[model samples]
Target: MTTPTLPENGEHLLARATAILAKGSQIEIRNLVRSLYPAEAAFVLEALEPEPRASLWRLIPPGVMGEVLIELNVEVATALLAITDRKDLMAATEQMGADGMVDLLHVLPEPLLSQVMESIGVHNRNRFEQALSYREHTAGGLMSQDVLTIRADVTLDVVSRYLRLRGRVPAGTDSLIVVDRKDSFQGVLAISQLLTHDPHTKVSELMDTKSPGISYKTPSRDVAALFERRKLLSVPVLADDGKVLGRITIDDILDVIREEADHSLMSMAGLTEEHDMFAPVVASAKRRALWLGVNLLTAFLAAWVIDLFEDTIQQIVVLAVLMPIVASMGGIAGSQTLTLVVRGLALGQISGGNARGLLFKEISVGLLNGLIWAVVVAAVAGVWFHNPHIGILLGAAMLINLVCAAFSGVAIPVLLQKIGVDPALAGGVLLTTVTDVVGFMTFLGLATLFLL
Candidate 1:
């Protein structure tokens, strides 16, 4: 199929492809799929429903299919892989790098995985196995075995000749990894040093030893942070015994950073970054039901708290009307603090050393905000109901709830993290519960003691 004119953007491409597919123009769809880059093709496929996605998947060239699969989210990729022909799967992976192959292996079933593994050459099979040994979210799994290594004792002239003979270096090869004869980590030699330095200079004489190799077991998030802090294009990944394993490039780190950002954003809504937007209705509902149930339970807890003070609410009906305001203000204030602390923890800015200070600061801010809003809310309540006592009780409840919300906001995330729960996923629900219960209890309990 010949390439057609590229669409302006992903939406346009999806629109054009949908129109073509509706017309039953298989050849046109093939050309359309082939015209865009792998990422763009993956985007269009993801945007389509299952039928159209499978249709477009069939049209993708085997050479590009591997890359498109690599670009897809885990759920979508796994679904596509399940129906794919074994021969087609082999063709798709034939030209893939170790890293790309590892990605496919993650979603492939045991039978298909074994077939694919057996199909690759021994050298590549070893590399793929080595990569598979590391957790998908760690440095080793994200690294590529296509690193260029040189002995530290080599001369600049020798390195230059080596590069010329090799014809091409790996993509993102900003520096040559320096290792000893036994492949122990030494340092890195920037490409600039090779071109500008005298030929007589030894690699060790010009190599930078300050930047250390990242351990293969290091978390991908921490690796991304290191890259951001050091402004690195690439870094060496080393085995536990300091043997060179592979190297992770900026592109890999960029993917990690993007996934992390997506994770944080999605988790706030009780979803995963890998969630399929077009998943089956039943599947989608099944995934969301657990969180919805959790939320319902929390809502019941808040309702139970309110039920305890039914008599006070009955005597002062205005308290029922004004109850939501107290809870809402506390929820909003706590959410603000929760967001700040979560971001700080993600960026490694908040730790044991500074967490106490941060907690005190957030509490103080909550107190100050409580005092300010309390007066405003109290004045409004007093005027609205013409009862100063009720107004004062409302204000006191607001202040108490806000303070408790602030404390819960900071403490909940830290505590959840300590127990190995994702704070982002569970923090919001827990915070809402705290604010609601505290706001209701303080407001109605005060009403019962005084106004009744």
Candidate 2:
């Protein structure tokens, strides 16, 4: 096939491909899509609506199908997999790396997954089963079995000859793993050292023993942090007995980091990173309805609290006007603290030892901010409503609510984390509820006591 002219910008390529797809020109779409790299092709597919996405997916060449599937979001990949022929699926997955295959298997239904597993060669089947043994969010699951390892006793000359015989190394082979006779964890030999050191130097003389191997059971988030902190190109995953399981490369860690960031951002809004942007209306609505229902319940709780002070609201009409100010201010303040605590928790920065200190710090910050904004709001309310008493009450309510907001912000995440709930997923909703209820109750309760 002749090379087609490529678009300079990704967006331009997507737009052009989309326009071509709109015209239902199959051959042109196929040529345009097949010309792009697998990742670029996946991008185009993801950018299209469901029907068009399916059309574009059908145009992708079989040779690069596996790579494109690897790049697509889980939801989109799973959808495509459901429609693909079993033979085609087997062909696409035949050459996939162990890590990629494991990822694919995760989204496949058990029956189809069994069929695909049965189709692979014995060696590959063993490798896939080993990788599948670990949890998907663990180091073993994130690692690839395609690692180059060297014996510690081998000299640089021997290493060079071996590399020459092998002809190529893995894609991210910045270093060669050095293992003992029993295939146990030892260390790594940097490629630079092999290239520059004396040919007579033994692998043990140059291997880095200080850099640690990650346990296969380590969480993927912790693995990503390790990679980031060490500036690692690759690290070995090892069993409890120090047997090398596999090696996680920078590319895999990058995927983990990205997935994590997406998870955090989406979880804040009660959504998943895997949520397809172009999902069908009913399906999307059904998924969203759960969170909306959760929010509605929280809204009702706040309304119930307001109902308790209904007489106060009726007697003091200004309380109704100034009430939102109290709740809104507290909500914003609590969110600021909540976001920080959740992030700190995710990074492993916040712990039991420092949590108390952090809590006090946040409370102090809330107090200072409450004093500042409270005075400002109090003065404005006094002048606007011509009542210093109402102004004083609003300011007191503001100060109390802000302080309560800060406390809840820190406490909510820590408590949720302890109870095995994801702080990022549940913390915001809980924090919002706390601030709203506290703000409403404090403002309205004070009104009921004094104004009534």
Candidate 3:
């Protein structure tokens, strides 16, 4: 008997699911969903609009729903959770990891959360509560309580025998964590060593003591960095007194990396990482309206700057024609610097010791570029307007605006971070305001003084 193969890519899966959904066959939909990985199923669900999404959701197996829910975007997950029965939700989550359950509880309604809490086993409930106590964006929240550990004094034979009795360990358990009698983390014993070594060897002799346990309070972003730099498959989370709390797997780190990437991309447009593409129209509009309003205010401020130089513009119509070029060039130059600084901040590459060096380097680049482009623009303006004075004014204005833009580009993000504002969200608006005002004031001010 031959079975069918599912497409590996999400787009193909979405297409197949959509086709099946259009046919409105419950059996076909259930078969399609049941065959997919939780993440693939989640992709198909998110790709559908609300009505079809609900239809597909009902077709997913109850055991896999918790996992699929974990894979979904926050808004989508929240929406799905709202319609699910509390007892059914608890049943779905019974086999879920403690960390995943904690995340779900946060988005669940108060009544649903209470019902689920009452239904879960006492040990699982305690772990969930512990995970929930920590900030969501920290190591503690991301760590799973289902850690497999061994005493440092145990022999490899004892470890192997104990593992055989337990049946199976959690996924991503590349090494067994070594702990002292007090449960303080000692080191790790690799599974390869456990399988290959002479059974008589003491666990303490073969354990890698150099591996460090991550502090529970560490930010999730920093934790992701550690995983990246160290190439860790799994790392132990430690309490303040050095007791082991849980383990953070590579899977959890992947989620953190995805979230940070999403955040950086969205924040530039003043949007949240969890923003749902298929969110209701009014809700989406409300979120975007605030950002648009902020941009409008900046636009008005730039216009006001130009209004002050209206007399110069009216007299020499060429000045008005050439004005936008200056502002546009300045804005582009500033945005390049701003993007670099924001990324540096996100990667922890920018620090107090090196920030001044980066600023100096950016300003120097601006000066060099401004000088080179200034001559080209000046020559173009002179040839086009048939006025050498207009050329000189345009050149000087370009140089001033570009230099200011470069300075603002580097300075704005740094200033925003110090004041606890997200540079990605606020930096573009502020940078545009600076470039427009300076570009207009410098170009038109020069023309007013010399050409007028």
In order of appearance, the predictions have TM-scores of 0.95, 0.95, 0.95
lDDT of 3 by residue, 1-452 (tens): 89996456877778888899899888888789878898888888788899998878876777888888888888998888877766667678787766667767777777777888888789877867777898889998888888888998889999999999999998888999999999999999999998798999999999999997999999999998888888899999999999999999999889899889889899989999787789999999999999999999999999999999887788888888899999999999999999999999888889899999999999999999999999999999999889989988888888988889889998999999999999998999999999999999999988888776
Q: Which candidate is the best by lDDT?
A: 1
Write down the TM-score for model 1.
0.95
lDDT of each: 0.89, 0.88, 0.88
Cα error, candidate 3, residue 369 (Å): 1.6
TM-score for model 3? 0.95
CA shift of 325, model 2, Å: 0.6
Model 3: per-residue Cα lDDT at residue 418: 95
In model 1, which runs have C-alpha deviations exceeding 4 angstroms? 1-24
TM-score of structure candidate 2: 0.95
lDDT of 2 by residue, 1-452 (tens): 99897456878878888788878887888788767887788888888888888877776666678888878888888888877777777787877766667777777778988998899889888878877888889997788888888899989999999999999888888898899999998899999997798999999999999978999999999998888787888999899999887899998888898899999999998899998889889989998888899999999999999999888888887788888999999999999999999999998899989999999999999999999988998898999999988999999999999999999999999999999999999998999899999999999998888887
Candidate 3 lDDT at 358 equals 93
For residue 178, model 2's alpha carbon misses the true position, in angstroms, by 1.0
- The local distance difference test score of model 2 is 0.88
How much lDDT does candidate 1 score? 0.89
